[model samples]
Target: MAEDAIVVDESLGSETLLDLRSLSVTYQTDQGPVPAVRGVDLTVRRGEVVGVAGESGCGKSTLASTVLRLQPATATVTGEVLVSGADVITMRWGELRALRWAGASIVFQGALHALNPVQSVGAQIGEPIRIHEPGIEDSEVTARISELLQQVGLSPSRAAMYPHQLSGGQRQRVMIAMALACRPALIVADEPTTALDVMVQAQVLGVLEKLVKDLDVGMMIISHDLSVLASSCDRIVVMYAGRVVEEGPAHAVFDRALHPYTAALSAAFPRVGDPAARFAPAGLAGDPPDPTSRPPGCSFAPRCPLAIEACREAEPELREIEPGRWAACIRVGEP
Candidate 1:
């Protein structure tokens, strides 16, 4: 329900809900301008779940924040972030505010920290409804809160509890409930399963997967764990040093990763029943380049096991290899 001026592009054809066209974000620090996200293009179609996987400080979080123009003033953002075809960067303040909960919503990680310790869970969930729908009766707000709670696998009775009173998984479910309160078309979940046990993580992901299918909404789940994305997402995009190194169908990328970074990440997490992987988990050595002083060639060349002199000459462009599969490495097909 953004302003009238913010209209959906007919070219998007109603399927693509969120699109990032060559998006980049740079933060101005005392040290210098640090490029957090660089020339990344991504999309999320209706009823599809897309996952963005990368290590800490690899710009996954920054990319999520930029979806709604949530980046700080010190950060310089470029390129288009089109949610339903409206550019978030160009929207007016009023339009942006209206677009937030109704058009798109975010489920931030660390539910304990994101929620209000003082407010009841119901109050927190109802707050967005009240702000977005002031004319709605208080009784109706309460009813909507209960429905959202039920949808996320939590009892309606749990609404009265505070954040501190709920378990970690319960708190995370509450966060999901809040994100669903407005029934937005798009949901950006930033590390939704972080800090939870494996069992709890599975529960949370199940909830998310079910909701996305039932509601027919597009979701982008960001995380450092490739396994989580592999299990939940339709497509997986692997990022390294502020750029996407490889992207493809979830199973293809997880089972046979083209990029060394993606392969290393996938191997880092052991499979439940795979004997060979159970005994020895792969470890990726070396650190990412400093943002302020990134090398001219491939940023990952220094740490790449298969790096050649050609890889150090210039940065490789992301190109389609086979059908929908894409990789930025010059030596993608090389054995």
Candidate 2:
């Protein structure tokens, strides 16, 4: 049977910005080869927001790293990472360097650490512009810096401030501006809202949301928080133990998840002002199986409350249970 395609509207933007085909990554550790991602296929159009949700160790970050060839030397990657129909894995050093900011960019998870403490935010944002467009005039670079800062909701004056001088949210916005500085077709944001207050998180998200709508830039946001993804993304892909477990429209995945792992994740977040959520929120027990020694059957079976004897026999392939909705579970649609 054909694989289920992610529901996309051609009118939104038919141009494919990022496409991953059967992509897998395994890290060569001192102990053994640890599989971080397994046979994951994803696509991001020119003007869309796709959210990747999963707990730590589920390969969410690894997937994001692979997009820009940012994975470490110890990691072995297989399959294609197509950025605008160009394969990143096979590109030469010169071509890869050129592709980093012009073809795609990344908003790293840690804003303070990612930015250089010594340089001003404006200089940092201008670095990519200068490197990618050496012929650009000084006046144009300054103007572009101010424009990007404004686009991310920061005052142009804030450009003079150092990383430590800005608040957490402001630093994140600066990172976003840096990502947009090159005007790349695709942006991969790995946990863009980490360690901020709920209100600040909303503001950061608002900046990203507005950028997507106004600039028509394709974005793939990776986070462990399902609620954040549910509120911001058009579509959500839920990962578990290095493989995608469920994927569908954001609202449907949050409200009516098909896989047990997705359901557990949805239940883990407490709803604001809801008494039941505050006091009786669901808790998922057990850690993900060790990647180097994963079981033969389902990686989630031992932790799943609905696991059956048959679940221990073989891993389930991701299949479409309904139009445009897919899940990897033998017991999907069962009452």
Candidate 2 per-residue lDDT over residues 5-97, each given as its tens digit: 133454343788999999999999999899999999998887778999999999999999988899999999999999999999888889999
User: lDDT tens string, model 1, 78-134?
Assistant: 999999999999899999999997899999999999999999999999999998988
Error of 1 at 273 (Å): 3.0
**TM-score on alpha carbons, each prediction:** 0.95, 0.96
What is the total number of backbone clashes in candidate 1? 0
List the global CA lDDT of all models.
0.91, 0.91
Report the alpha-carbon TM-score of model 1 versus the true structure.
Answer: 0.95
Model 2 spans > 4 angstroms off = 1-8, 272-274
